[model samples]
Target: MNIKFKNFIWGVITLSVISSCDISDNKDVNPADSFLRIYDSHQFDHEIRPVDVTQTADNGYLFLGNYRRDDVDFLGTYISSVDEEGHFIRNTYLRDNNVHPVGKFLVLGGEHYFISMDAVSLQAYLNQVDDSARVVSTIGIGTTYPMYAENDGEDQFVLLSYSSVNRTTVLSLVNADGSITSQSAFGIGAGQEVEEPIIDHFTRTGRELPFFAGRSVDGTYYANGFYNYTLSLLFTDLSDNTPSGVIQGQLDQGGISSLLSLSGDNYAVARFNYGDQYANAIATLNTSGISSSTDIEGNPMLEWAYDEKVKMTTMTLGNADYIIIATTTKNQQIALHFYDNTGAYIAVDYLGFSSPYQLGAIQVTSDNGLAILGSTQVAGKFQRLCLFKKSESELNDLVQ
Candidate 1:
């Protein structure tokens, strides 16, 4: 969940933890006749933008994202599939015209995958979607932000990117019809090499990168990006893709849009805490660092503090454990925030109006309630695609 915007010089746009988990028994079903669903793409100036959501294989509700067509110069990547009240049965557009898409959406064993980045071979594809969302295969990855991926069995998978030729931070091991069986590259300190060390000019000066990837409960394969803007963490070795350590700066500021693993070497970060403005927090890392942190108070974050923008995620309902966040509201609506998992403070919902909304991911449906994909600003200037549900006693009655 890393939803940020402001880079339309026409271009460039870009979860974890477990254990003690058994929070499902709310089979009380009866609150989804339509809990706020809107896939309006606003009639014609098309511009979809949700980045993830899952629960299919019969339970229906997929929704990946990326779209464009304010009348022509198209761009694509979308997959819809709703039901369980949110409507919309099938919607497709996997790779069209100038297909420039990448929004790391996943769902392993039961199928439906995502990761794209190729506008004339900038290479890094890996598509797979059926059950109506079409495009059953795509595969091409010589490297470049596969964005994020994970699934180590039942056919194998693991792809996360950043490697403009070894600038470090790469991993590939696909297969389940997307072959690539093995590959690796990583860097941050010691000798500067993934088996070749020193590549001068300060290690190719590629501005180290990595978006997000996870798996740890002894299986390793962690990654969180940022280099010339600090924030780092890398640890790989899923049997062979070596490179065992690198954990720089522990978020000196911003740059960790989301990451979760929470149970052993604990993890759960959602960043953007510019010291004294644009605040947004939710920390609980491990590997010897941040033990707790929370900041996401009311008044749209301390009264607009500095034009905010945040997006976070984490779910579970019956026995409880949540952390949703999604900020930026003070008339320009879109504020959600529902902590639990010991941090307490259970609810707060306020969605769009006066145009200007942006939440990118949050899912936990199939009766337990809460599905909120993003992008909204209707009629007053297009920009549609918004789905918002909320049940389970209307989100625990906002902590009653």
Candidate 2:
């Protein structure tokens, strides 16, 4: 394992230690002031799997995840606010009368907020939270599943919604105050031949896909997912839900977890090949069409080389893009691989544990640091949230 060290003062550290009575008893697993902070379930026998994180107005971070309490099968939304140095500011759990799994969060009016849904009521809500992890305002948006939501530049948000009953996808415009401005559904007539990219891709004989859409830097929205279990990508104008171009991969039974818009016309996507037992890949999408991913050495992946399932994430620093892939090997060791924008390898770091650990999410903090969150069994018999961070200087050394 290539471990790099940077200057970190120890005197200013204020740690939040978890008690064994509530969660696990093992407390001797500290990482010697390397900027790696792990938070166990100190409050109760529960698990918190973070799904997304955003940089706060004070240059700190707000993490959102799924919180599973003890003796309960339902999972609630969890939020944690931390200082710029990765110190805990506040932690809280948000739940409704039904199942609520938060997908991601965005910053509006210099405040952190997110949209989530309830499984039973099937209604979606926008929650505006304060610095102390308390909800100050709430706005209700009726029954529609948010596939993706992100800032649309001027204190507004653009999101994609999927309607299962009509099997239609809609692009919605939301104001900063959490009100629906307008929604444009994918306007395709039944049995009417349309010459759009997404329409052509989906109209082919295949299984119904839980369609997803993402916006590019220039505000162009594209939809990508499995069409007949094959990878299909398309660009939509969003004016009338009409697609412009389309591309499809030959790989079967694979799905994308996330889509990241790169600096310019290029984009990256994280893929999981269920046909090969959770084997994963990182591919590039552009006007040149789809390109298969390779390692830093340019070697093709026959399988998850580590014999464990892998999850990948992409982020940018300056004008350069990077990817962080977390792999759980056969020995139950959780590891992370760093790569540059071209899919070339950079460096690798190991979490060094003999328990099952699943990667939940990754984020690049405002201070150029890295925040990694996952679920690990090392804390006890069941999984507990494992959160860690590395300083900006140390992260720079990895790619250098």
Relative to the unseen true structure, what is the C-alpha lDDT of residue 143 in candidate 1, on a scale of 0 to 100?
Answer: 73
Segments in model 1 whose C-alpha atoms lie over 4 Å from true places: 1-62, 65-78, 81-85, 95-101, 104-115, 123-143, 146-161, 170-369, 372-388, 397-400
Which candidate has the highest TM-score of all? 2
Backbone clashes under 3 angstroms, per model: 5, 1
Cα deviation at 289, candidate 2, in Å, is: 9.3
Worst 10 residues of 1 by lDDT: 14-23
Model 1 gets an lDDT of 0.56
lDDT of 2: 0.55
Q: Encode model 2's per-residue lDDT on 264-326: one tens digit a residue.
A: 555545444443322122343543344332211123233333323344566665567778766
Measured against the true structure, the TM-scores of the candidates, in listed sequence, are 0.31, 0.70
Error of 2 at 160 (Å): 2.8
Task: Flag clash pairs in model 2.
Answer: 296-345
